[model samples]
Target: MAEHANIPAGKGRSNAAILVACVAFVAGMVGMSFAAVPLYRMFCQVTGYNGTTQRVEQVSSVILDRTMRVTFDANVAPGLMWNFKPVEREVMPKIGETVKVHFTATNHSSEPKKGQAVFNVTPMEAAAYFNKIECFCFTDIELKPGETLDMPVVFFIDPEIVNTVETKDIGTITLSYTFYPQEETKPVAVLPAGKADGNQKL
Candidate 1:
């Protein structure tokens, strides 16, 4: 009887150990799931994957003679009652030449609205070479009823873009932005106080 009892006790301890290990594994997975989004965003920012462009304060001094056409595009996500578009349809700039462009957003609804923009560039290969010094993306944009604002983006194409075999033949790159309504219940703070256009980076 004693021997039999010992066997059952040992089996119960083994089962409990297995249960604890499984729970720890599951918790670890859940933690990673929460971290996945920001991690992927950092990866995209670094590698320019999925048309993501690099952010920098300044670019190289070497300006290439080669010119490239840059097209602007804007869109609004569903449920966001706003009119958003690029002020300029297209611009021709030499490689490494910094250019500034504007996008206008108007809130057509009666109440205040908050939005954030997701941006990308194409042909996708050029994304790696497209650098932005300041942009309205990655920040909350709030607009009062009937408010219109001009958003600015300052950027340059890396002069070394010509050296990349993948983007050598690309003559045009399109920078696109899409605004989606923020789902948070509380209103997010708007851009810092500055010019009427609020072109300053926060």
Candidate 2:
């Protein structure tokens, strides 16, 4: 009689373990599926660092500086279907001098277009010395079909950059933008005391 009772109790324990294991697997899968959106977002934000890409609310400041033009040119990527061109291809910003860039972005698509842009200082060498004060890429721009906007970005080459050992050799920095339709659109809230609406400021 004792042995019979022990066998049934042991089987019951084995069944409980199997049920727990199955529940754990299902929970893990559910958790992972829900995490996909936030995970992809984290990857884009860190890699891109564009306020527009980050989808933060505020007037996106164009983050760039007029330091050097090292192989400078602008082009639209395949997906963006937009235009990115600088008013001036090559610019000279003296130490402590501030300059403005007129980046004309035109939406070529028939639907509302959006995108984020970034400027890279080549050689991956002078990144430490680069300093950018103001930019439009920090904000989001919404365009009606076939609309063109004159976006202004003001930046200055930091006086320290010229003094820095590594960046002094840099002669050019290229500023460019790429526009694409936003996925998982996050609204950038307008501040109450912020500059006028997008139209008013432009």
Candidate 3:
């Protein structure tokens, strides 16, 4: 009876150890959940895994004969009372040539508004080949009541895009941005002003 009692005690200790391991694993996974978003964002930026493009300091000098149509898109999140649109419908630029475009944003609210833009490119694989030299999306934007500003983005299509089999056939890419009011700012809503309803898709 003593020996049998020792066997059960040993089994109890083994079960306790397994339970501790499982708890530790669950805790570790929960901790990772908090860090997942930013980590995944960094990974995508580095690898262009999803339509996230590259940011380069200097423009590429090597130009290619291939041309691509770059389109712009904009949207204001429900909580944000602002009008935003691309200045142009589309641009055709040869590979490796830099181009500049503007997006105008206006606050239609009676109170000051603060917002930030989140952007991505379409045709996910082509993201790795789109390089941005300068972009207003890098920082937060604030607008006084009824104030308007033209945001600019300077970019170039990488000439190397032609070398990659995955992106070689992609002759068009759309750069889209969506603006959301900062939660901390607590922006008030107001009726939209002129041309605010124009959400052009081209």
Candidate 4:
């Protein structure tokens, strides 16, 4: 009778162990899914995969006689009532020459709003050689009602681009930016009243 009674208890213990293992496995997968996005973004930024551009601290030191036409494009995601556009349509800069371009954003809505910009370079192959030294896209932007702000981007094309078979023949590169509405957060510094633009980084 005692031996028979122990059988059910042993089976229960086995089932409980399996249940715990399954729960742990599910938890691990959930954690990985949460981490995957930022990890993948970092990977893309470093490798310039999928049209992602590279970020650099210093401007390129080498300048070539060759020049490339770089065009700018801007967009605003739905729900953000803002007017965003590149100040310049296109620029022709020599390889390795640092260029500064401006973009303007105006908040047309009645309330203050926040936005974050994402950027990419087309001719996907050329993204690997296009580098940004300083850009407004690096952080979130805030604008009060009826306020207009001018943002700047500083970048350069790598001279080695001409040596790379994949990008050597590329004549033009297009850089595009899209702004999406962001939830309200810590306020960003704003320009003094009556000032439409300022040199300060937003």
Q: Which candidate tops lDDT? A: 4
Give RMSD to native, each candidate.
10.9, 12.9, 12.9, 11.4
What tens digits encode model 3's per-residue C-alpha lDDT throughout 1-202? 4553346878899999999999999999999999999999888878777889888899898998878999999999998899999999799999999999999999999998889998899999999888998888888899999999999999999888888899888889999999988756455875456435776345
lDDT of 1 by residue, 4-100 (tens): 4356878899999999999999999999999999999888888889999999887668788889999999999999999999999999989999999
Query: Over all chains combined, what TM-score does candidate 2 have?
Result: 0.55
Task: Report the Cα lDDT for candidate 4.
Answer: 0.94
Ten-residue segment with the worst summed lDDT in candidate 4?
Answer: 193-202
Query: Candidate 4 on 3-116: residue-level lDDT in tens?
Result: 544568789999999999999999999999999999998887898898889999998889999899999999999999999999999999999999999999999999999999
Q: What is the C-alpha lDDT of each candidate?
A: 0.91, 0.59, 0.89, 0.94
Predicted structure with the largest TM-score when compared to the true one = 1
Which should have the higher TM-score, number 2 or number 3? Answer: 3
TM-score (C-alpha, index-matched) for candidate 1? 0.86
Clashes of 3: 0
**Which residue pairs clash within candidate 1?**
none
